[model samples]
Target: MIKLYGMTGSGNCWKPAVLMKQLGQPFEWTEINTLKGETRTPEFLALNANGRVPLLIVNGRKLAESNAMLCYLADGTDYFPADRWQRAKILEWMFFEQYSHEPYIATVRFWVHFMQKQEEWKDKIAEAMKKGHAALGVMEQQLQKTSFLAGARYSIADIALYAYTHVAHEGGYDLNAYPAINDWMKRLEAQPKFEKMTG
Candidate 1:
């Protein structure tokens, strides 16, 4: 059986769990409390040198990085796609999520929601929100042209971006302006076997 080690409310950790559920693949979950420093322990560090959650153990081999897990689990599945160009496009959005989107959106959410730094770190949060909104604008532009992030069909690219975006409000982001993104999110939520992330 596949084993996943992750924190309950983390969007990065939720990515693979959602995919596995959609695929009807049963897996064991081991909760890691990042707030309690569980990820930094020697045992956890031995499994993943980076000391991050969302670690996967499959057939005795361990895999780290949430996006990498998505790609691995979705390979040859409709989520990953077979066309080279389509795959490339999917990867394009995945990379964009990690670099442009998650850093701003997810980090701010962590700071404001998890750390309760809304007032304490107001200035820093404001700056990050600018970049987060920029990323949302890019997503909105593409979503206006395509039904999904990569193209007409839903893919891991959507999963990658959706993880943080749906909960962007927690980071004090106003999604009311992005009509296209809202619609796309509704479409994604309606997919078969789709599971909502748990807190």
Candidate 2:
């Protein structure tokens, strides 16, 4: 069985959980309470020196990084593309997701919803959100033109961004301005095997 260490509400963690449900794969979830410093402990640190959640332990070997794990589990599955160029395109979007998208989107959620009254990050929070919406604007532009991010078909790229984007409001970004993004989000939610991140 695959064992996953992640916080339930995290977009990165939700990536695998959502994929498992969509693919009908069997797995066990062990939520790592980062708020309690569970991920920083010796045992957890051994799994990932970065001390991040969403670690996938398969057959005693651990894989870190949420998007990387998504690629691993999704290989040869419907979520993965068979065409090399298309696969490359998917990777491009995945890279953009981690670099351009996650920093802002995830940070906003962390600051606004999760961090709460932690004044330490208040300034960074406000700054991240402004950048976050700009990132969403990129998505809105792509969603306006293309049905999905990578190819004409739905792929892991959609799943990669969907986790945080769907809940972007929690980060204080208004979705009403991006009708195309909202429509695309609704389409993803309407998929036959779609799964929600909130447990």
Candidate RMSDs in Å, in order, are 0.5, 1.6
- Candidate 2 similarity to native, TM-score: 0.94
* Top candidate when judged by lDDT against the true structure: 1
lDDT of 2 by residue, 1-199 (tens): 9999889899999998888888888999997888899999998888899999899989999999888988999999868868899889888888888998899888777777887743767787777878888888988888888998875788899999998898888877788998988888888998777888883
Model 2 lDDT-worst window of ten: 117-126
lDDT of 1 by residue, 22-120 (tens): 999999999999999999999999999999989999999999999999999999999998899999999999999999999999999999889999999
Best by TM-score: 1
TM per candidate? 0.99, 0.94
Q: Could you tell me which 10 consecutive residues in candidate 1 have the lowest summed lDDT?
A: 190-199
lDDT of 1 at 128: 94
